[model samples]
Target: MFKKLKDGVNSLKKKVEEKTGIKEEEIRPEEIPETQETDEKPIDKDSDVKDKKTSFKNKAKKFIKERKVILSEDDVEDPISDFKFDLIENDVAFDVAEKIGEDVKKDLVGQEIKWREDVGKIVNESLRNSILNIFTSEFEFNRYIKETDKPVVIIFVGTNGVGKTTTIAKMAKMLRDKDYKTVLANGDTFRAGAMEQIEKHGEKLDLKVIKHQEGSDPAAVIYDAVEFAQANNYDIVLGDTAGRMHTDVNLMDQIKKIKRVVDPNLVFFVDEAVAGSDAVERAREFDEAVDIDASILTKIDADVSGGAAISISYATKNPIIFVGTGQSYDDLRKFDPEWFVEEIVG
Candidate 1:
């Protein structure tokens, strides 16, 4: 697909060059005027010049219509390099941009493009596909999800303000709508509004949420939620952990303790897609704290230019299980690779 676009642009460049030469050949430097008996003119130099100029104009117009130039790599000192720099400005990693530029060049070098078309379009599509392909890397979420017979606990873990609780709520809503007997564990006992935010979603979904008082032990809250799910008939339990800096060892240890208590079926690392490379760095810390079964990419709808969605799974080696498209529960998507590819490429 990218090759075709590059070829078209190169062809346009060639045609433009050819048309310029043809136009020059059609024009004359001097002209003669027509003879007029009344004026006693020997020749009409001015009239002839005007006629030739009009002729050249018509020919040039025709040439422009028939021929267009397709820009080549040699036509510019560094076309793909400039494009890569633009990508970096858009928050794509330098290394990732370099790889994309190489891929674009490889696909474009030998291709034949049509005249008058912009090669940048090809570059854009190639870059888009390259990024979308990262999100498309598949994994078996059902493997971990179906392994447990009792209440399958899923702990949502991430740094502070990364939409961890909201992602938990979205998951709970999904499970509830599927008739999975869902329970939400508000284990984020540190944040002031964390419990309230989670409870709002729980109320909307009508799912039972277990939350302890603020400043309580998050691990104990998770333990109680697990026990509650087990005692009841709930099939799915989603525990929300307090968000903190990835570098904070104390908070990391707290999450580790919670994982020990719940033995969750999947430890989901929720990160905002707009955070770019920072999202990848945070994932590393969170994954080190617990056995993360998968990842959930949040705020994708507002993060069109960010590459975090593309880079996170590649960095962590954890498959993206879900993508949050918006704040509503219905906005949560199951992270279909095909759909992602289609939407992004189109």
Candidate 2:
């Protein structure tokens, strides 16, 4: 995954080396002394070592004085422009791409490149820090739920065909494996097989499922599930909602009503990582309507550009809690900013 983004970063490294005319070996001050010949007549070994150290220090000072430490704006203009274009072409939002470019430029330009500091390394660190800044909110999902009150209500919301139901099942299994008594609430009564799908998953996991008949009020189903959880002392209540388009006013209003009735502890917006820019916009729309607590991106293993994962959290100002990597219940992995940056830039 993210092959294009990784390749772009590699290209940027080359650009940094080319523009600065500074090789990795040239940046190391220690390597210079090895090339110098030993004195023909060494009076004392300790004195010779001291003299060599002094000579190396003087050479380092002179090298530092002669080399340009600060990069000019014009020197990095072309590389930054190319990077921004690559991000946009890889499905990053336009504003997000611009912000990334601006951040890289701000950190790179006029910065002192010290001894043993490669320009490529500096550029990579600048980009990493800029991307890390976007992930302001980070939390451990399992730990948070464990600490929260019993019968923690969580609602899953997203547009159609984003694997909302399947993601909910995966989460239920995860909580169950953690020894939390979980219950699945089939609140997606508007969909044809939503109840059965969740029910089957519940049966496999040996967890109870709360539901109403088809065409029943979704909020009532959640309310009953919450009530059951409270009565039974269940650890979590995972509610599955019907997939509805964000632009549909009537369906969006239904979700708002569900929120009021259940007052869930967390509302997770599900999306497909492969959906690219469309997923980012949809998440924004849902967040504007009902204010999601976090997000879950499915099909992450299949996504190549990985722009949706990079852009959605920053755009929505919400952290991505987990990403679905495969079809198994254990495929869900918590989002880690450091891991993501390393994968893209290493």
Candidate 3:
């Protein structure tokens, strides 16, 4: 994919260089010297140096005018299909990519066009529609805290190594900043380093984190965490569950048990944007195991195209509550559908 982008840029550079008889770097209109025309004597009145320069400039402009990010008609029966395939190759799920492309096509059909100047606008609008399809809206945080009689419980679930713990910390920070007293439930008691990592994050954020020893029952941990929150009158409770493979029945059953105990208001399927199609597959598995209230897409900064962000939201019909753009606690942000759509198509 990187190679393809580089090849495209190089090809354009070559085309410009061949026509202008100047290096690609020197072709910049602002960088070119103004006195080069006067420095040389005119050779022919009919077809002189000025004429050659004008011809080259025209050729260069024509080449640039034809530049396209999408494929030509000869490349495939459906350019949209080809573009969707490219998106899947960028880590977007096949179904999701297809849906996005179809949505774009639907939005574009029967649109009035006066001139070719609208081509970019049409493509941008199409891609924007595709992105809008993927973005899930976040829950109203203030409403959740203020309206609920019981402490709002948020359970973070995903396959191992998807930054569930880090995301919990970030959310806790957000809650604290909002002046809501938040508690962290260290439900991930299986891995050796899990407790310590979550504990450190809790310490850094200056929030209370409840944890048990290694090999402890995860369900019990969550139950006790809820009890602690209730007793202490915590505004919110965030649980960090043990990372388990979606295929693990024992783990899934345990999660179901925990869900019964806490009955959380929100169950977030935390995923990395780099996972793309795999993220969708994992999300389906997790949703089947437990009711995923919403989604939280992590590692957005790591993804250049962000196909996973679009795919998960579109696939599950679950709102994306937050996006983790970096490893820092401050990188967490609420999902914005409009901005996301504009960025994708543009």
Candidate 4:
């Protein structure tokens, strides 16, 4: 997935190795046998400790508590700066890249590298931590669903062609498996086939879709859906709104009015992972317009740079509840920060 990031980290490791022939211990454990005396004497008590650093081949190598090589900021400053540029070139937002760089630099500068530990391990591990820190939230949608009040209302908002409708359908399937009685609400009345698109998904999933005729009030549609959920004891209501650009003031105001009318428990900002920084900016704007509860990023499997996935949560200050990995209903997975980092670095 993050082939670019992986390669960049690898390149940085090699550069650090080449730039500063910093120091490897000449006294390896294998050279010192258990009972046999070797010509290589132990570090002289009278000699300068800085003159000799020891490395060992023993499986339990952490016994030595001494810091052999201390990394200076100058040693990694240029290499880490180049890596930050690589992150930006890969579609990661500039602010996010800066944060990652600063975190990595702060972590690596003056750090201790133990004996038998190569610079590559220390460098890559630091990079991994810096990248993972950008994903600040560990929000779980399943917990929210299980604990939140029944008939919970979630309104999905985003620009057109970002898979908002399909994502709603996917979420409905997920809720149904959990034995939650769910209903689909078509709040999008602007587009010509908007009603049919959601209806088709509703029919396939065997869920009821509530809607109004074309050019009707969107807020009214979702209001009616909420009413229906209350009467029928539905566990949740998934409402789909007409996709519109952030520049469209009227449409943005329409969403605001719907939020006011329904007072949805959650507002989901849906967009594609492939949209990169553009998706992050859109999520920010949407969050400003209507406070977002979480985000759902589609086409994650197709995204190579991982910019949207890395930047959206940090930008919006809202958790990414789910990521659409593929086209199937089963492809939706809860966002896990640890797992995502592993996928990239492991």
Arranged by TM-score, best first? 2, 4, 3, 1
Residue-wise lDDT of candidate 3 within 166-208, one digit each (tens)? Answer: 9999889988998989999999988989988998998898989
Better of 3 and 4 by lDDT: 4
- Give one digit per residue, the lDDT tens place, for model 4 in 211-261: 999999999999999999999999999999999998789989999999999
Pairs in clash, predicted candidate 4: 151-235
Superposition error at 37 for model 3 (Å): 36
Q: Which segments of candidate 2 are over 4 A away from where they belong?
A: 24-69, 114-117
Q: After superposition, how far is residue 163 of candidate 4 from its true place, in Å?
A: 1.1
Q: Looking at model 4, report the run of 10 residues with the lowest lDDT sum.
A: 54-63
Which pairs, if any, clash in model 3? 136-320
Clashes of each: 28, 0, 1, 1
Please state the error at residue 144 of candidate 1 in Å.
6.0
lDDT of 1 at 147: 60
User: Which parts of model 3 have CA positions greater than 4 angstroms off?
Assistant: 1-77, 134-138
lDDT of candidate 2? 0.86
**Candidate 4 deviant stretches above 4 angstroms:** 22-67
Q: Rank by lDDT, descending?
A: 2, 4, 3, 1
TM-scores, all models, native as reference: 0.72, 0.86, 0.76, 0.85
> Model 1 reaches what TM-score against the true structure?
0.72
